[model samples]
Target: MRQIRRLLLLISAVWAAAPLWAEGERAGDFDYYVLSLSWSPTWCALEGDARHSPQCDASEDFGWVLHGLWPQDEDGGYPSYCRTPKRDPSRAETAAMADIMGTDGAAWYQWKKHGRCSGLSAGTYLGAARLAYGAVKRPEVFRKLPREVTLPASVVEQAFLKANPKMTPDMITVTCKAGRIQEARICLTRKLELRDCGAGVDRDCTLEDALLEPIR
Candidate 1:
């Protein structure tokens, strides 16, 4: 009886230690999507400039760019890196997303990590990503800034709400990283309609004054 109990305990421990997005999780099993929009200038200021990324070039004029459309579980844990039968996107396919994603590599990575979990083919997933990106109206006020500035992170969220009247505070989250405004993540249904973010996706940055770099 002691040996049997020990074996049962071992099995329970293994189950508890397993990650949320295990390798074999079924695709298209998530409840909603989190559309991440990264602020290009902040990325450049944080890491892109050091690497001399092309998106950081003055001529690029990139402001808010699609980071990824992620599948999320309503509870808190989310799926990632799920197995999919779809073939990987080709160079041309990924490159086409560079205009809005900042780089082809970013597009490819997003497909590998998140898109695969959507249970859609690479082409279809990329197309859905584009549609989701276009659905959000990026605020033009930030684009017109002539120089860097510091402001409350909530102000960023408010800007998005004001620009998108359909979006409520629960549907959007502003995040800060390394003292800079990083990204604005908005929740959406599978059909690309605005929706409230899940519990795990509702974390908003609490920075009183976060630095925002002007578009380069």
Candidate 2:
């Protein structure tokens, strides 16, 4: 009886803290967004021409593209599939997201997976995503980067801070894979300004020097 009671209390506590976990709430009622910017070259090297999309095209310079603007909680956990859209985005909608994100598949996936939980319409969510991405100021290192650059993930963090005065290291994280940086996650407030991502969102790279591969 004591164990059962404790478990019940724990469940109640989690339920009470809906905002922290992005659960038990309507869409758009949660915390800020994590504007995930993918290092396009990493994707190209990993997936190659097999995926065969505009984003993976060699002719286009997709250095760092908007992966998705995800709704994140105070904790690392985020909400998803809170609601389902009755229909898909129109052609115009897909086109609108092309430059900011990639293709219809990318836009629609973000819409269905993350945007739906945002409590905003597809248009509003995507528009906000684009706006949030546009607000970010890129670092010079990424623009004029060598074909293969290596530095600690924190080095990348410092570069961003130097470039954007309003930004702090706490507001962003670098995601790496196979000793290479896959993405740089920069968090923002609802107003699209730099904000600290809490402890839940952490730098998970175990590498000493994270490689930023070229956009070949």
Number of the top candidate by TM-score?
Answer: 1
- Candidate 2, residue 210: Cα displacement in angstroms equals 1.7
How many clashes (backbone N, Cα, C below 3 Å) per candidate? 0, 1
Q: What is the lDDT of residue 12 in candidate 2?
A: 100
TM-score of each model, in listed order: 0.88, 0.81
- For each candidate, the alpha-carbon lDDT, in order, equals 0.92, 0.77
Where in model 1 is the C-alpha error above 4 Å? 1-24
Model 2 clash number: 1
CA displacement after TM-score superposition, residue 116 of candidate 1 (Å): 0.5
lDDT of 2: 0.77
lDDT tens readout by residue for model 1, 34-98: 99999998899889999998989888999999999998899977778888777889999999999
- What is the Å distance of residue 179 in model 2 from its true position? 1.2
Candidate 2 lDDT, tens digit per residue, 1-216?
A: 999999999999988976433233356756888899888888777774678877877677777788898888887788786644334567789678878675667888887678877877778788888888887876867877667988787777777678778887788887888888888788888777788896577664656788887665
